[model samples]
Target: MDRRKFLSATGLGAVALGAASTSVGAAPKTAAPAAKGGPAKFKLGCQSAPFDDEHFAFFARYGVRNCSSSAKILDPGRIYPTVDELKTLTDMGDRHGVSVDMVDSVLLTSSHIDREKNPAIMLAQDPQRDRDIEAFQTLIRNCAAAGIPAVKYNMSILGVLRSGKVKGRGDSEYLAWNLAEAKPPTPLTRAGVVDADRFWERITYFLDRVAPVAKEYKVKIACHPQDPGVPPSGYQGVDRVLGTIDGLKKFITINENPYHGLNFCQGTVSEDLRDPGTEIFDVIRYFGNRKKIFNVHFRNIKGHRDNFAEVFPDEGDVNFLEAIKVYKEVGYDGMLMPDHVPEVPGKPEARLENFAFAYGYIRGLIQAADHLA
Candidate 1:
């Protein structure tokens, strides 16, 4: 295709060339989506990605660029990372050709509610939750001051759940979840017996406090969904409000700020439904069209809700090529990285090797999507 036709066909014709400093000390400009009216470019990014030199070398070896870091250079627990400290992280990534575009929240992530440091925020405890929320707000201010665009987080009380593992292609172990076979060490967690009413109440309380701060800082606070959907009767003696599609739909509307959105885990959301292959597209469109998806965990599954296995990108129930096209169709401009990968053994760098496959697979899909007629 000619340049003009290619641009028009792929919806890149009006994409304004936007640049933001992604490193410390008057760093070089990186081209990205404009603040407004530009086409949203789908960046291939990794989440919970490495930050150290050796790990950075691994990612750079495969040409990975933008990603959310699990780095503690600017930790929320110690002190609010000064703008300089935040820039220090970006500078480190710059040395390895990666950009630390987002950072995971220190106090609130996927940790079990009982094990959480910021439990007050999710537990509806007064004053203390307010203190915890203040720290997050401070982190947001530092992030914006340092030119970082987003902060990814989770409000998960139960964290992730899986029943067992099933052998997949090439003898890989796919993370499986079968409700019938599911077993918890105990009937309830310390958070105990939260109904949907109470769950929503806690969720809103956190949002009502944090959403305004996020908007003011222009930092996107991304929330991940509950791992696998549980029954209305509840699991582990707790109700997970973010586990269902209906619940997730209601979640983004609470404070209705631009910064409060989802981390959009495709794999987990796939595990939430009966038929992920067919049901996922509309869900993608619903969130994507609303411009609420901050980052995407572009992994896949092999079966439906309550009976599934987390599989590789290519050999899953969802047509990832189609999913990528839908992301393009809806102008999702963030990183699409793998969140969960099947454990396929026998490689020297077994874990990184699996991740490498996902990164390459994603790049391949993006290339195909870019040229498809």
Candidate 2:
């Protein structure tokens, strides 16, 4: 099937839910939109920076042009001058010749797990939900004021776990059957997990409330696909969100908003597609330029169904050549990060080395492609 047709088949029709009506302050007209240029030389970035902004100065030093960062640094509750602090960080990045391409939402992923354990953190639940909403709204407003372009949020509710301690590998951090301990081959149900209906209601409400403000502030909201390619058991009370290709399609189709986009994690979807290199072109052809794809995680796995390992970005089952070619063909200008690399041996900093290797390799691919052009 073609990319457009594939997406259409997977997309679920949905309506915007109780979206907030508040307006985000006007974006300054002086800030220019991203220029249409040839492919950018990709770079290596971490979801969380181990050190201060200074640690990432190496990106600019190496001519690595973009950095994908966590939105945590801009939290007003934790720190002050939140918006200016972010802009200053970005400005420093520009000074070093590195640009902040995307600000990933922290509230849902790791933060969600933390909230799950400490129910008080969940803003969507009861009295806390209202306060959480207000706090999050303030965050969005802060990001807008900082001139941050996009914020990606995930909808995974209960955390997935497999029972047992995972063994660590020298090449990577730790490859486990499940991040959480749980029985395998269990029956799956949408149940109380982040269901399609609940996701639509929450996301639509968020987008409707935030999209216009984001537009006014010149920022975009990108949602990531549910990881693991399956729903956590409803009976077990495990949470799952956007676990399939169809789930992702439902997210975009439901809102039917251009501002709504995706964080296309190749590894997660590869669990479903089996051959990552094969259907990727279709995804790009369909979601590309349509403005649905905002960021990409370039990782690979060994097996297709129910089992896999995170391998070196260069040596994975996914054909990087075809993937890069498809990305270029579709004019994808979004950030492509070498995600979840195997840890190197004994250095204690193997991830950084793996990231550098992937970054260099992808850059060479782009350069080679550009030469052919």
Candidate 3:
């Protein structure tokens, strides 16, 4: 089916979809908006993939006041959430004094292309694309109803590609990705190879449909960059966009809606370019200045693009102190969370322990930056 027919049939056309507004009647119960002069104090948070009550307790214990949880918390088996389910989840967070600020999970079903599906449709393809868009719209509405501020998503068809684990500072295992060790790229769809242009077009199509809904709901849409790194060609199976600074600029400009921004993965950005330290600072300055950074995956890495080892925030190549300063200069007042950490052997609470360490380190940076300011 052609684009026009597809949109028409799916009721995605501007007028038709616009008429069926998804805004909820009641506003979510949450904190007051920060005053409009200088930057507001930012919150430190974490993602609980398999979100549960225990996760909240952990966050509360560590004095983490924000959370980015999996959409699975709402419908364990599906990607979408009903209003009631969203309310229940948010209420759970509230009880522990932690705010459910964002929700994320795998929006795409498969990592690689399946020959059984039409390449054209599968790439930007039909029913699935339509359903995904609707699911995202519903998610935005539900987030608004529950007072969640953002939805983080990734557009990469290839997903994350990691090679092996590498040893880190404290004899911990960190997931490493080296392009040399990476598997060869395969066709993303049965039709053949997907190009950068096509990948971006699909992304634009998604944003066009969803951004308006997000705006109406007052929920920000934050796109995650292609993880590991975006290859000169594509990585592991498809062309990756939004991996570099240029790509990120393209992404933010694609939709003019203020609600369209980034989840801002610091480690991924550091890994995407040749000079991570310099480039990462520039990225934060550029996006943060525009207030397009809705949240942050505040982690660090050992190397640059195509080959890197994940590391704790303090031990990486990037100067996170400068990172905090940049965020401050850009007036970013969003949640910053440690995206990844090493898994120490023989440690039952390795993740939590790593998080606690990261929390302390980042908190120190924020405080130090404030003092300098």
Candidate 4:
């Protein structure tokens, strides 16, 4: 991202900027051929976690057009969202001119494994998991009935792991993970000793049940990858099978349904690589080309592999501007939203400020990339 400023100083940025403006302003009839998903249509989106009028208003103020919602309808009290409840979410979005493109709550999130809603689904437990899968399938059908195209969820026993937080850049605290500093408890999670083989068995069991339901309902199921993969020797007696690109490749092929894809958290993926700045674009291209990327958790990291800090997009190891270009290259047509914004000192307002910066920056990058090539 800093390189863009350097390019500006050298006049290259000006030239590209001008070319971009002209192309963007040109008639649509002059456009070039697009990839399988068709010409890239990058929309700025957000988690809108609460999905209340306040968050919806915030999105509208920033011109956000699409979002992954955690609307009240999907609250934990409810096992499956009623079509009317979901419509209420859309109606709320409609009032703010935002489309509720995706929802989470069905499979819960990447929260602690013990607190996860569908524990049986990940534990590979039968009778109970069957009920869980049935509810999930209903959620997929409900998404179709409600016109929400995707549902982002997590399937992890450990959830997101971190060593600690460190302060930086105007006193903002960064979420960090250094495996060397971690002292995972001996008992691990309640899931106990889930090896790679056992983990895959659990993952496939859930996918086998729900992939067809997703396909039938025409709802995309976006599974998030494990955050910051550790060494295979095992982390606290558990093996994370979905923490690597190879595992992810295997994942999409399991049920082999077009509706099955990823939520593509780039920062987490970078943590699994030796050199994220050099390696991420190829990864993006791989998924984007296959249309396996349904949504993106667009944030950056300051380091690679087992040790890294989740940082602002501009100062991370990966060049997000270049990454945006590659996303354009792959013809990705989905919400590219910020996921892990660091904690700046402004209390709740600081969080909003960080999100504002990320959303605005991403929107600008998308516009610039669209015009560049």
Q: Which stretches of candidate 3 lie over 4 Å from their true place?
A: 1-40, 71-78, 105-122, 185-192, 346-348
Q: Top TM-score: which candidate number?
A: 4
Model 3 C-alpha RMSD to native: 13.5
lDDT of 3: 0.70
**Which tens-of-lDDT digit does each residue in 1-373 have in candidate 3?**
3334433432322321101111112332122222234433777888855577888888888778898886444445666777777777788888999888888734642244452322222367687778767877888888888778888877765556677776556568778776666555453435356677787788788888888898899999888877755555655445666666677787788766889998898888877756565556666767887889998989997666666778788777687777776677667888888977789888858878888888888777666656663
What local lDDT does model 1 show for residue 75?
45
TM-score to true structure, per model: 0.86, 0.75, 0.82, 0.88
Model 2, residue 124: distance off in Å is 3.4
TM-score of 3: 0.82
Candidate 3 or 4, higher TM-score?
A: 4
Which is better, 1 or 3, measured by TM-score?
Answer: 1
As for lDDT, the candidate ahead, 1 or 4, is 4
Q: Tens-digit lDDT track for model 4 on 1-373?
A: 3434423432322221100011111222212233223345778999956778888999988878899886465465668888888899999999999999998855646877777866788877879888888888888888899999999988888889998876656768888877776777555778888888998988888889899999988999999998867666668677777888778888999999899999999988887776677777778877888999999999998766776778898888788877887788777889999988988755877888889999998988877776674
Query: Cα deviation in Å at residue 224, candidate 2?
Result: 1.4
Error of 2 at 218 (Å): 2.2
Clashes of 4: 0
Please name the candidate that would achieve the greatest lDDT relative to the true structure. 4
For candidate 2, what is the total of clashing residue pairs?
14
| lDDT winner between candidates 1 and 3 | 1
Q: Each prediction's Cα RMSD?
A: 11.9, 10.6, 13.5, 8.9
